[model samples]
Target: MTVSVAALIVASPALAQEVQPVPAPEPSQVPLIRMAPAEDEQVEEPQDQGEDGEPASTELPPEPVVAIPQEWAPVPTTPEGRSAYGYYLAGRSALASGDTQQGAVLLQQANRLTPEQPRLREQAFTAAILAGDLKFAAGIVPDAPGVSPTITEAGQLIRGIETYLADGARKANRLLAERPVEMPHDRAATYAQVWIAAEAGDWNRALAAPPADFDPISTLVARSNRARLLEIRRRYEEAENEWKELTAHAVAGSLFRLGYGEFLERRRRGEEALALYTAAIQAGQAEPRIYLAQQRVMNKQRPPATLRYREGVAMSLRTAADQMVAQNANEFAAVYLRLSQQISPNAQTQAYIGQTLINGNLPGAGRAVLAEIPPSEGPLYANARAQRGMSFDKSGMNEEALAEFKLAAEAAPDDAPIVYALANMLIKMERFEEALEILNGPLLNTADQIYEVRFMRGAALEAVGRRAEAEAELNAALALQPNEPSALNYLGYLWVESGERVDEGIALIQRALAADPEDGHYLDSLGWGYFKSGKPEQALEPIEKAVAKEPANAEINDHLGDVYWALGRQKEAGFQWQRVLTLDVDDKRRAEVEAKLKDRLNQLPYDRVAPAVVPATQP
Candidate 1:
């Protein structure tokens, strides 16, 4: 679901207005770095030619520098250029420090100073939209349209909302039909139009023929919208069939199930709703939302009335945001969600907004929204705590992460995800036995993530020296997921080192390597397996490649050093061993590598060095 933006746009759980604003500093005094895209993922722009070798965009480029005033927030009465520079710098600092709300304010001020800076205005617009202030972003384009066409769509959409409220549905429909949103974003406009038309008591738009170039995802979303519209059209038979078809779609399966069940509930079909929810749970789709739906049904509560215009728009944006989030366009998703929240303030939307902020690395803002979900909210409250725990863990606050995870787990003992999260954190801190206690607990015995549970149990058992049980668990996990490379590589590595089945272990790792040839950990396992089998010549190449794949990995480096020593390259081995010490090696590995550096090995150590996977493995 697309989260409502700005539900967490504050720096804390308190209202946004409660925070004191920072004043702009002197331009020369402010030293800030240029903001880079998240994850350093390069987004290529149109050059002389587009990707298909077509001519550059038909739209006119941004003009020469022209300062545009921002009406969203007050700007200091200083020189436009100077204030823009200072506020821009300060905004960059705030964003870097995870204060999204403050950064949005400062960036908004900066844009007011110099909106003609295409990149600068775009950045400010993004921050504003992400803060769930789409109207503010929309305001930027009137003075400086070149800053963003994306926000131009936002402008029209919000205006349509205003028109719908002030005038009537017919006039609003006319205005909304002028959606100039281009491709990629065109679908969002199309969906929004459907909702607005419905409010005008029209179903033609919902059942209309697709545009010639309408995308597949948009088509599917439209069809989902059609299902609901069919019901409104008094075509219950057709609506039921559409619901079945939609719920059967692989991608739409569980996602649409909730909507379908809700539809059933709204029609007063409680038994059908319960059956649907029960079947989903039995099939291992035991999500918190499903359980919540089940609880509501049991209590004989009525579902909400049929979709209103605003509600439909919110749902459309949310569904679009879901696709965007899936594609790692979380920042864009936040924009859609923020607008959705403005139209309708649902807790689900708030949760999604928090998640998008967290995914976008604006964790402080995420925590602000999540903190508002009180304990009385059940699954949502647990999810809020769990999301906060993830943010804490990412910031290296390990203790806080564990505490939050514990709380989430306590609240949802039968919830597999929460339980797994708590266990994973314990395992990260090397509290393996504690992890084992939870993994072995009743919560996940019949859970959806059974394969993952089995694999984790195997690893935890191995850590505590229960090799036989560990192997059994690993085998059982493989039985559940026969092609799972992680289990294959890990068990294979273990078997190779333990001298029980050398060739078989090598083959197992080889099989795992087939899944993803360039995976650093799998490469390391294959190399280490060869080394353990006394074929240093075979080990040399893969180990070197593994080091190249994970240059800063201490364990991979240590493995490379051992391979070098086995192959009689003592000097290079010593150099690699020295390099390992400079990496994030633990005390035990430090001692091992240091000893290997001091004593040139005449032979490879018979004792196995546990690979990184034993703990730091990615499934």
Candidate 2:
């Protein structure tokens, strides 16, 4: 199951005091997940990050893999089945390429030809919804046990929403009320009632009792929902009280802060909103979202909340999309997203739906959605451009990726996060001078810089051969955030490689390893530290284990070869060095690897591998 709405309305810090750690997932799911720098980990509400940034050495994770099927089932052999199979294959290809309109057409044709195949119909219905053909999807909606499309929840909800747009609220509420009052359907129906009643100008029913029990996640959303409705209904006191309770308890600088502050601004309480944003910033919530909110208020916004009933219903649909997308079957969220768009087209919704499609591996559909956003939506357009860069990177179109990032940076030059992101892509592409210039630029050269800025700048400096400067920057980063494992690993490895503070470097790497035992980079750093400290004997085991964990890593393999050679395993060392040449090493590393294989090798006396021994470096 997806934790959608819950992901959005996070339990406040106080509510989250008794946090339970999630259990580890299987290693198969971690197919190469990070970028070279911290900015790659952009926190988008909850899921914004470069999905294609990780090295293959990074152990694949299983969590985000969720329950998506990989291979398709075989099609039947009858005449209609074969024709439908061809159309299905073509439609799937079209969808993968981001041509949802044609894809939906082809998929619907396949379903028509293969009416008995439930899966085909499901695919067609999904494509139709994603293509914004809601009525068509609703007409052919399947009745499954889950939101994959049960009439009790998703199906009835979609149908009712369509009805409200066509036949009005009374008729829609009648249909919505008929859905089985089960767990999810009960909640969906309750939300539907409020929106429908609001449309009919019935405040009593609109502010009815809780959908079910008041769980933390639902309660937060429910309070937010009730407060918004209250304000819309001109019940000012109740709305203000509700906002107070939420602001007091919300996770610092969350979207709730944004929502509440926006509400205050619209109510002509600009000073109060400014105070809220200021408090959030002073409380160590320096996120751009809060800064943007403060900027909006200072510019003198208009007074009092004024939105039509349709707009209210559209906002509720956006909320429902957030909830549904958090589930494992996130593709279904597009149903709600498209429906919301049909009612009220906005850049925020388009960006969100676009991102959802991209993250869910529907890059074609995602790119198409993102492309539809007008450039007039300043920051939103810039973000969409960045996402396009990510999509390009994932597709191996490196030039296109960099170009898109450049466009984003140019468009939002003052947006610190976007600047950092462009620099990140440059660093990854070995365009270090360009990246260093950006890092050293005025926008990022502030005194109280975040750890990411410091660490990434250190990395860029190191790449451009500024040794002492890199170390000092990394030290500044370390001082800013002492327990950050990535910073520790990078600085430790830098020192180990340059023969500076080797012993202390070993300790730092050990700390990094302790923080994340499965990190291949940390393991390699530990082994390299041992070798640099003149104990190749101590280096063998961790290096070997590191190789096992990341067999495809050129650097780790090179380290293993050096360890093997020092221990009299000369033949194996030569084999390892030869293998490094075939892996994706840099040109400089390739030259060194070639020299090692040719001039420096003669087999030694050792005929077998030595027994493993634990290094003192183990934490």
Please report the candidate that would top TM-score against the real structure.
2
lDDT of 1 by residue, 184-293 (tens): 35666677677778778666765675565654445556777877877778788888887888678654355567778888988889899999999899987656778988
Clashing pairs in 1: 2-318, 5-337, 5-338
Residue 602 accuracy (lDDT) in model 1? 44
Q: What do the candidate models score in CA lDDT, each in turn? A: 0.73, 0.72
Q: Cα deviation of 7 in candidate 1 (Å)? A: 26
Candidate 2 per-residue lDDT over residues 197-239, each given as its tens digit: 7777667777875655645555556667777788888898888
lDDT (Cα, 0-100) at 545 in candidate 1: 95
Candidate 1 local accuracy as lDDT?
Answer: 0.73
RMSD of 1: 12.0
Local error of candidate 2 at residue 232 (angstroms): 6.0
